[model samples]
Target: MLAFERLGIRFGGNQAVQDVTGSLTPGKITAIIGPNGAGKTTFFNMLSGFYKPTSGVITLSGQPISGRPTHEVVARGVARTFQTTTLYKNLSALENAVLGHRVRTKAGLLDALLRSGRERHDESESLKAAHHALERVGLERKAHVTASLLSQEEQKRVSIASALATQPSILLLDEPAGGLNPEETARLMDLIRQLVGAGLTVALIEHKMNLVMGLADQVMVLHHGQLIAQGPPAEVSRNPAVITAYLGSHGGGGQHGQSAPAGGASV
Candidate 1:
């Protein structure tokens, strides 16, 4: 399990996340939901090692990992996707995915310069891994395509392929359904479920309550950097504090087709 103990972060005098504690079980999908400025992405940043928490500890299967560098975290079996797609636009999808295996490669600069046997071996392994990752995300056919030329949904899948190439135990996704149409969103949802079914732990920060309610095994509600409620979706959805914090007067009722509020905090 991935666990956070009283995790908190402060930006100057402003507290972005405070005393937030939670555990994400392996092989399950956990959804993080909240309104603008609710610190949803801030929490994700800390988990992915992009931000070092000002206080508290984070542990994965009993090993402390808080404040580790991002690459180190990836090496430790955690990989993530951002709200904004991060890809090498000029690179082919397969090449971009191959880059994700950098942390696991042992070939040195000297090996590359000399074109040694080890370099060749590692390169071959990386290519195979990249192809498998793309296949997992249903993007194998687009492997040779330039990232910039793919549709938004395809770009998102490429990003996911890159993360999968790392062979992570935990996958953190931020706003994956952000700009997707309903059909695309449904496909993405099915993909996520398939991943979880294949024994991966997924934690997503999503604005779409419909996706959250339908897909998550556990739901965590954040409000102004604090965890206001957490439980199964049915339970969290009915919590009055959670409703006031983000669900609004609809009480999460009409959230099926609605988007999140404008200018929501990113991190």
Candidate 2:
């Protein structure tokens, strides 16, 4: 399990995340939901090693990994995708996927310069892994296509494929459904479930209540950098604190200027 205890971070005088604690169980999907500025992304950044928490501890299978470098985190079975697609537009999908295997590569500068047997073996392994990742996402047919030519949904899949290539036990996805149409979103949802079924732990930060409610095994609600509610989807949706946080005093009413879906009180 990936666990957080009082995990928090401060930027200068601003406390971006504070006193948040949670655990992502293995082989399950955990969704983090909150309004803008609620510090959901901040919390994710801390987990991915983009930012170090000012106070708290993070552990993977009981081993502390709070302030480690990003590469180290990846090496320790944690890999993540961003809110925005981060692929090289000019690169083929296969090439982009191969980059994710960097942490597993053992070839040194000498191996590269001399074209040693180890370098060739690593290259062959990376190519095989990349193709497998693309196949996992149903994108193996598009391996040779440049990223820029793919549709938004396809690009998102490529990003996911890249992360999968890293062979992580824990996957962190930031807004994986951000710009997809309903059909695409549904497909992505199925893909997430399949990954969890295969024993990969998934922790996602999402604003779409429908996806969170439908896909998550557990839901965590954040407000103003603090954890406001956590439980199974049905229970968390009915929590008065969660309702108030999302809809303000108009709890059962409209979205209250929030971009969340209408009747999002159901979480």
Candidate 1 global CA lDDT score: 0.89
lDDT assessment of candidate 2? 0.89
lDDT by residue (tens digit), candidate 2, 142-220? 9999999999999999999999999999999999999997799999999999889988999999887888888999988
lDDT of each: 0.89, 0.89
Which candidate ranks first by TM-score, i.e. highest? Answer: 2
Q: On a 0 to 1 TM-score scale, where does candidate 2 land against the true structure?
A: 0.95
Those runs of model 2 whose alpha carbons end farther than 4 Å from true positions after fitting are 250-256, 259-267
Span of 10 residues, lowest total lDDT, candidate 2: 258-267
Residues 1-106 of candidate 1: C-alpha lDDT, one tens digit per residue: 8899999999999999999998998999999988778898999999999999999999988999999999989999999999999999999999999999877788
Task: Quote each prediction's TM-score.
Answer: 0.92, 0.95
- Cα error, residue 137 of model 1, in Å, equals 0.6
